[model samples]
Target chain A: MRHSDQDLRTLMRAAQGGDRAAYRAALAALADWLGGYFARRIAPAQVDDLVQETLLSVHRKRSSYDPDRPFFPWVAAIARYRWIDALRARARRPETSLEAEPPVASPEEPVLARLSLDQLIGHLPAPQARAITLTKVEGRSVAETARLTGQSESAVKVNVHRGLRKLAALVESE
Target chain B: MTERLDMMIDDLAAELAPQPAVRERDGRRAALAAALVTIALVIGLLGLRPQLVNGVADALVLVTTALFALLALAAGLSAIRMAQPAVGAPRGGALWLFVAMLLFPAIALVEHLVGRPADAQAQIGLMCLLNGVGASLFTAAVIVRHLRRGAPVLPEAAGLCTGLAAGAVGAVAITLECGGSSFAHLAFFHVGIVAAWALIGRLVLARLVRW
Candidate 1:
């Protein structure tokens, strides 16, 4: 999930130079990368087949890799080309792809969430800011914030709207 | 999926054969050599047209042959580059060659209307067209086979380049052997190689270069 470009390139170079261990490691890293790549677009069962196909393709075209250029684009191009071929073949025999279940994002790459609510909310006018921070950032319901802050439910909604607009403008201008 | 891919990689690693240390530029050199040999064989077997000796003295004949020679070089280089996708897209040299070949005749036709020596006669001969087609198919098949072993990503572009490479050779053959100076004859007989291949390259390579 966190392989660096230099590390991958070194592994590939060693692999190209006939180091079996390096080759195995490179393939391992690539398989991990491709799992996340395909999982986002395809069913779980389909990911393995595409990964296998892409690995085989990359191995075949290893000689074409230019040492001067970055490796990921060349590798990704082969994967995309192989995927198109698979799509074309599957289209001709439609029964193969139908058996797979629902698609899902890759479990290997956990999605991270980061919100800077305090900074954004601080940019709003004081009353509107308080309403937004209490409802959105502090996880309070509008009715709860209205009762706590002595504002009507409709007034809380209007303040929250104004707060969101200011936050969006500040973020956009930056 | 991870387990299956790991097993697949192990199989691949176990069977991994050492690839030849060929540089990207080497493909271009190899393709050009192949093209030259094909052109040579075609010329030797078919024999140059008897008019070539006298025809070379003519300005249009020199111009036409020179144009096709450039086409041949461009198409050959493009085909080789296309074999290695990382190098970039195949050059548009073949397309330019085609446009020039088509444009030259129209210019000649206009000149004929103006009483200049356009020599725009129409000679319909299936023999040269058939010969050009045969040579083009043969040359293209061989080069494409070699390129396919390299696992070209853009089979269609590679196929078009293959056709152009073969067409370049066929164009040379037609230019060397055809005695006709007619605009229609040269367009239909000589330049037809590029046109035919450009049309069929996509369909043919889809099957031939399948992943």
Candidate 2:
């Protein structure tokens, strides 16, 4: 659902003046907008958490919003601030890094492959990179690659096929 | 998740009461008033410099006092605006004013190194430092209170501006009462107080303002 800036502003103005219905509508509209906003910037799994946090911030800092101003810009600023905070917090977390995933291929795989191999693999998600490296690059049997990467043999084949397709797409675009 | 969000919205709406929108001008006005009151109290306790009363305060004294007043006004307004954050809000000219205010300390350091006859009065200097810091407390409280009432995106920047603004207020309050004309005194006691407050704002006030 989309809300016009004017509609949001009017609702916000009334909300500031203690109109409960207007306040609820305004917040609901804001929550929807915040969902879309964060979905564009972060992973799907993280979007809901950021949306909730931004809404909480809006509720606490409602007084900071001026009735004369456009409501979206003010709300957008709060969302951006929360997004930055989330990004900083995520950066500080060591367990979330791509390197934390299972190392299926040998450490010397990068040296033997083309210089762009690591950079291309870096573009893929961790699972895709691990699957493609083990089954395709290392020429390991599908059953062995699955066992090493802790995936089912079928899942391993799917990831390698998807990863190669994405690599091809990336190379063509470049 | 949708159900959770709906519940949250209901809860927030239920708790809603009439809330006045935070105005940047109001925060600035409150901080300015607090600074003015502190200045008056400090001046009342320790009378104006003799030269100022005689209408013959030197060029350096007049200039330094004026700089402090300007810095207080600039940084004070900037701090208030930061509390009411907006996307792409242009940071005001407080940064330039702060840079301008540093000239005094640079001059003081040069003078000290050149070995000019020391105009040292350990007791008076220490008293001015304490009084300068004391005068800033109220102004900083007013600004920080305003910050708590709103949402500041860059809390560290807000805190630094708060310190600069409050320190400048203290410097303005004590400048009229101080008779010290030496660069070292102005640098150490006046500008030093502002620097100390800015550091405190960055380290201490950031945590207070963080959401």
Best by TM-score: 2
DockQ of each: 0.18, 0.36
Give the DockQ-based CAPRI class for model 2.
acceptable
What's the count of clashing pairs in each model shown? 0, 0
Residue A14 lDDT in model 1?
71
Best-fitting candidate, scored by DockQ = 2
Off by over 4 Å in 2: A97-174, B116-123
Give one digit per residue, the lDDT tens place, for model 1 in B15-117: 7766653454666666667667766777788777667755545565667778877876777676765555452343576767767777765765566668775
- Candidate 1 per-residue C-alpha lDDT over A82-133 given as tens digits, one digit per residue, 9 for 90 to 100: 6555544432432222323443345542221113445555677888888866
Q: What is the interface RMSD of each candidate, in Å?
A: 5.0, 4.5
Query: In candidate 1, how many Å is residue B96 off?
Result: 4.6
lDDT of each: 0.66, 0.80
Q: Which 10 residues in a row give candidate 2 chain A its minimum summed lDDT?
A: A91-100
